[model samples]
Target: MAYRVQGVVVREKDAPATIETVIVPDPGPGEAVVDIITSGVCHTDLHYQQGGISDDFPFLLGHEATGRVSAVGEGVTEIAVGDRVILNWRAVCGQCRACAKGQPQYCFNTHNATQKMTLEDGTELSAALGIGAFIEKTLVAAGQCTKIDEESDAAAVGLLGCGVMAGIGAAINTGEVKRGESVAVIGCGGVGTAAIAGAQLAGATTIIAVDIDDAKLEQAKRFGATHTVNSKNEDPVAAIQALTGGFGADVVIDAVGRPETYKQAFYARDLAGRVVLVGVPTPEMQLELPLLDVFGRGGSLKSSWYGDCLPSRDFAMLIDQYKLGRLDLDGFVTERVGLGDVEASFAKMGDGTVLRSVVEL
Candidate 1:
């Protein structure tokens, strides 16, 4: 059977996200249907609206989500009805080379449902990151549903579905921040601030937050940033150095995808420190730096895709931390909103006042 549900969709390039009647079909083989409990309005959803991600019009927005398994398709065994889960885009194919190498996090062939959700007119809607959840219920590859703690706050832990996971994974997974290390994160947006929280969770002694917004810098402090640098007034690299005993931080994460911010992250780390880029850049953005500097830097340069996270492992662990009050996942939730407020939340994103505007069903 099929169900008609209201979902947020962008019908044209540069169009506003709107509520539409989405037709969610019954789960096909290897697919499942989820009844969304909460979903986060992420910048990726905005990108979908503005055509930054793809030209697929009538794109179903919202990927960061937690929900329950309402129905399962044939061949599904890992999850059953009523199971609470965090939705993940990467449904790793275990036979992929990356998975065979014991690094399934880099799975080359991630899975998405072959069946498409559509409008009443039968126009297929592209699911953002293949896990659109702004609607009441959504269809996805069964593997995309990572079973999570039933008691976890859907509004908080569901963020692991995207941006929050990226940030925390940038520091802990990709950057591998160690205890007593000095860490600096550039771009104190949700992801950047989450990087600070990751560093703190990993026991970094000093965590520096950098951004142009002073208020955001203040917000970073609550996430365990020991020093805040308003890059608007001073050279961020210099400020980071000053905060780290005149040297540089052991790990520097670039959460802003712009080339300028990447350069700052490159120069703001110690000679042998790691540089991790967790930001999502546009196609037109380009980077040019001295090859000699790259060679002389003597440190690793890495890009974090989904924070290099393995949802099967990371999500449950992070949720455990959130439950233990070690990770402030709740703090990341700036406001709770409904599906109608998603488009408005996009406007609030630029103002730096909100970290995440979660849509609770």
Candidate 2:
């Protein structure tokens, strides 16, 4: 049997996302149907609305979500009905080359539900990141559901399915920040601030937060940034270097993902330090650096995809940290909203005042 529910969909490029009747098919052999409890409004959703991600019109716009497994199809055993799960796009195929090398986080082959959800008129809806959840129910590959504690706050834990996880994993998994190390993160948006929280959780004592906004800089301190740099007034590279006693940070993460910011990150780290790019850049953007300087910078330059995270492992552990009061995941929830406010939430993304406007079902 099929299920019909209300969901958010962007019908065309730059069109406003609207609530529509979504037809969710019964789970297939390796699929599971989820009843979404909470979904976070992320910038990626806005990108989909603007046709930045793809030209697939009538796109289902939600990925960072937490829900309960309503049903499972044949051969689906990783999750069961009544299990609370965080919906993830990284449904790692265990047989992939990366998985074989014990790095499932880098799984070369990931998948989503073979069956597509669609509109009442039979137009197929493209699920954003392959795990749309701005609905009462969503269908996904069984592996995309990571079972979590039922007691966990759906709004907070659901964020782990995307942006929050990307940020935290950038610091802990990709950056590999160590105890007492110095780290600098540029861009104090949702992801960058989360990186600061991750660096703090990883035992980094000197965390520098750089951004063009003073309000965001003040917000960064609550997440464990020891110093804040308003780049609008001073040079971020020089500010970060001075904060680290003129030696530069051990790890510099460019969350802005622009050529200028990338260059700043390149010049803001210590000689043998690490530079991690967690931000997503546009396709047309390009960066040029002298080969001589690239050779002179002895540190590693890395780009983190989904924070290089292994969902099953990282989601549960992070939730546990949230439960223990060690990580303030709740702090990331700036507000609780309903599905109708999604477009308004998108308009709010520009001012940079809110962290997340979570839709609680």
Candidate 3:
């Protein structure tokens, strides 16, 4: 039987998201229906409403979510009913070349539910990132659900579904931060702070957080940054070099994804140091650097897509770390709001007023 549930949807660009009744079809082969308990309002959701992502009208907005499996479809054996899980966007196909080479994080073929969730009028709603979850229940490929400890806080762990995971994975997996290494993260939003936490978790001795806002810098300190640089007032590259014994950091991550910030990240690293770009840039934005400097840097210049994470491996490890108190997942949750408050939450995001405004269903 089909299930009708309330969800947040943006019918057109620049329109406020409204709570509408959406029809969720029963799980088909290799799919599962999840009773979403909590969902995070991310920048991606806001982008969708603003038409920054695509022209997919009436897009189902939220993606970062945690829930329990309420039903499973035929051929779905890995996840069972009542399992606590976090929904992920990437469900790798093992046959892809990236997966064949054992780097499933870059899998060219990812899977989503074969079925569609539509409106009462029968208009098919495009799920954001293939996992629209700002609703009571959502349907997804079984592989998109990563089971974790049931005792973990839903609002906190749900962050792992998107921004938080990207941030943590950028530092730990993409940057490959090592003990006693010096690292600098530009931007103190959810992703930047997560990079700081990940750097600390990896035993980085000196973690420098560069941001334009003082409040965000303070939040970065709480996430384990050893030093803070207000880029708005001073030169970030110089500040980073000054913080690291007149030599730049061993690894620098650009979390802001602007051409200017990317340039700072490039020059703010020690010779042969790594630079990781985790920020999502707009299509019109282009980055340019001196070819000589690129060659002279002599280290890896890489972009981290979803933190280069293998959900099966990274999710459980992060959960274990959270349980052991090594990772402060709760610090990421600045406030918990209801589904109706998502639009207001997006307004606050621009000013860094809240790290994450989670929706508790």
Candidate 4:
């Protein structure tokens, strides 16, 4: 049977997200219905409201979520009802060339539920990041659910579904920050701080956090940054170099996703060091750099899609780490709000006042 639930939805560009009656149909083949416990208010959700992601109006927003399996449809076998899980956008299609090559993190063709959630009038709603989790219940591809330890807090680990995972994966998976290496993350937002924490876990000896906001830089310290650079007061690239004894960091991640920050990441790394871009940029933006600088920088320049993570592997491992007190997933949840507060929470995100405003369902 289809379920009726209230969800946050943006009807048009520049419109405020309002709670709407969403129709979540019973899962079809290869789909599952989840009773969401909590969902985080991520920047991506805001992007959907602003139409920065697509022209698909009537976007069912919210993606970072954790929930319990409530129902499964035909042919779904990997997960069962009552299992705790984190939702992931990238449900890899194993037959895709990227997945067939064992690089499923870069799966060229990801999957979502074939069925659509609709408005009361039968208007189709595009699920944000293909999950559309800001509701009491959501339908998703069976593969999109990754079971995790039930003991974990739904509000905390739910963040692993998106921004947080991207940040951590940028450092640990993409940059491959090794023990005792110097690491710098530009943009001390939720994603950037996760990169710092990831670097710390990977044993980065000197973790430098650069951001325009001093408060965010301070918050980065709790995430294991050894030094903070207020870019508004100093040149971040220069500060990063100075902190690393004028040699530059071994890995520099651009989490701000602007041309300026990308250039900073490009120049802030040591020779042969890695630069990982995890920040989402608008299509109107363009980047130009001297060809000589590209050649002079003899290391990898990579973009992180959901932190290039394999959810089945990374989510459970990170959840265990959180349970073991090694990873601070709890630190990411700044405030807990009900679903109705999503718009107000979105406003707080602009000032970097909260790491996350989670909607606890």
| RMSD of each candidate relative to the true structure | 0.8, 0.7, 0.8, 0.7
lDDT of 4 by residue, 48-82 (tens): 89889999999999999999999999999999999
Question: Candidate 1, residue 226: CA error in Å?
Answer: 0.4
| Candidate 4: regions farther than 4 A off | none
Question: Candidate 1, after superposition: displacement of residue 140 in Å?
Answer: 0.4
lDDT of 3 by residue, 1-361 (tens): 9999999999999999989999999999999999999999998899899998999898988999999999999999899999999999989889989999988999889999999999999999999999999999999999999998878999998999999999999999999999999999999899999999999999999999999999889889988999999998999999999999998999999999999999999999999999999988987999899999999889989999999998989998998999999999998998999989988999889777999999999
Candidate 1 lDDT, 1-361, residue by residue in tens: 9989999988999988889999999999999999999999898888888889989778999999999999999999999999999999889999989999999999999999899999999999999999889999999999999998767788999999999999999999999999999999999888998999999999999999999988998999999999989898999999999988898999999999999999999999999999999999999999999999999989899999999999999998998899899999999899999999998899999777799999999
Residue pairs in candidate 1 whose N, alpha carbon or C atoms collide under 3 angstroms: none
Model 1, stretches more than 4 Å misplaced? none
Taken over the whole model, the C-alpha lDDT of each candidate is 0.93, 0.93, 0.94, 0.94
Error of 3 at 81 (Å): 0.9
Backbone clashes in candidate 3 total 0
User: Distance from true position, residue 310, model 3, in Å?
Assistant: 0.9
Which stretches of candidate 3 lie above 4 Å from their native place? none
Cα lDDT of candidate 1 equals 0.93
Residue range with the least summed lDDT across 10 consecutive positions in model 3:
343-352
Worst 10 residues of 1 by lDDT: 147-156
